[model samples]
Target: MTSVQTEVVEDPKGLLNEDDHMRDMERLRMEIVAIRQPFDSVMRVTGRIEPVDPVTWTLPNVAVRIEVESPAGQRPVSRVYTIRRYDSALGEVEIDFVLHDDDSPAMRWLHAVQPGDDVWMTGPRPHFVPDHASGKQAAIFADETAIPAVFAILEAWPADATGTVWIEAGSLAAVDELPEVEGVEVHILQRAKDEAAGTTGRLFAAARSAVADVSGWTVWAAGERQEMRDLRNHFRAAGMARDDLKVLGYWKKGTSSSELDRMRLAEYARMRESGLSMDDMRDADIAV
Candidate 1:
């Protein structure tokens, strides 16, 4: 496992010598310390965009696999991701940018590039592994940002294992280009931002009901921060094991990635401090 730690400074161009500009540029690269790894080495993968499944394309060097480096003393993690699919043949990763000015450096880089543009690839440290029960099925709730990871996990599952997926998109048009997998069910939740009030709760109810009939149920949710928390709460309230759920805040309303870290970390801390054990909650739990 590997861990990564990164810090960003604005106007980094003023901090280096003329001959060391290249090294400074490399250091100035946008990075997120999502994981820590001792043996994890970052590879600058530069490849042509390789088109895979019809709905999904590859961003050559854009796909990275690395061990997580945990300078934070957290567990080691390593994960793979297709940051962007740049070319059907080669070049940097091609990531989608919604054209928002409030994006991180990565998002800015993605939005600023053309078809043949190059990108720098970095760490996969601090990876997240599915924490589901060995014999149980996995259910995923995601949006566009989380799709790649969801796909990775589903692809990695044992042949005998099965699962379902529920995706939320801005519109029905968002359903374009998806991976085709055997024994996986996909559902879409399309609603305008203003119309999405109370939607998370409704979906959680449906998911809870669906999980109730299954043997070993593991819940994974990603998307809007508030909705993600609600889904997590629903699982916890339903007595899902503490270790059986994974919730992520892919992004949030009107918030940049930099702004999201503190909120999510604080929320996670509160969740851990709530201190409601699985056994105690399980005893009082009722199925949806």
Candidate 2:
């Protein structure tokens, strides 16, 4: 959830040109319009951004890196979040922050942010979506941290495609918020109140038991780093295509995202030296 900031220069007209390569890379100032706790585990923030248009800004599973101050207020930190909903007509974007017990930068910012607060962010970076056009059944595995992304994906889900989603969360209410697609079935793996998140292997176990034949499925799994890596390895070993299995490690247990970002940056430097692009970098190969 950490990123390296890049400053993008705007064009002469004071608006990003549509053909600009960094159109989506520029810094965006979002004015907080509302903040609410839709569920015990989530803090929903609705923010308004400029130049909003359905065709240009609306994309499934888009993410943003919001700059926030560290607990000591001495340094700025960035945290990535998925856009849970985007209302182009209203020029508002909804971001959900998953609640955790730790006093992380994002958590601190979440508690301190308020209505009318303006936050600077970078992105609308489109993440992966299910390969519905492949004509295969989509298999989705997610934990609470990934629920916002799951919500966005389901909202834009194709009507003719079929899929199954397995979510691990402490509350059924969080799962209920997901859009119910006609051809998609969703199963919830509820955790106990005392149980810590990312500690259970229920998602991996359920996926192994339910998906007997990998040939008919395309996978999208994201959550804890180790769990996601395990899921990717399992499916790849079962002969699933590289492109068919889109797994991402949103965060790691017992590790801060800042540390993860550091490792990624080092690896990226190595890749750049070898004339490789960002697409050549693999999250599962990061070795924690």
Candidate with top TM-score is 2
lDDT for each residue of candidate 1 in 1-288, tens digit (9 for 90 to 100): 111333121222332223222221111122321221111112223334322232232212123422222234532222224443333333223233222334344433333444343333333223344554456677878765565556555555556666788876554443444565677677876657565432444456557666774337777776666667667787877788777776765556654443443333344334335852222322112211
Give the TM-score of each candidate: 0.55, 0.89
282: Cα error in model 1, Å:
22
Question: What is the TM-score (0 to 1) of candidate 2?
Answer: 0.89
lDDT of 1 at 237: 77
Task: List model 2 lDDT by residue over 1-288, tens digit each.
Answer: 333222111123422223232344656789999999997998989999984334545778888878765324223467789988888878899998889987677887889999999988877778899999889999999998889899989998988999999999998999998887899999999999889888898889988999889999999998988888888888888888998998999999988777786676667667756877576888778889
Cα displacement (angstroms), candidate 1, residue 235, comes to 0.8
Task: Show the colliding residue pairs in model 2.
Answer: none
Q: Which stretches of candidate 2 lie over 4 Å from their true place?
A: 1-23, 51-56, 70-75
What Cα-based lDDT does every candidate model obtain?
0.46, 0.81
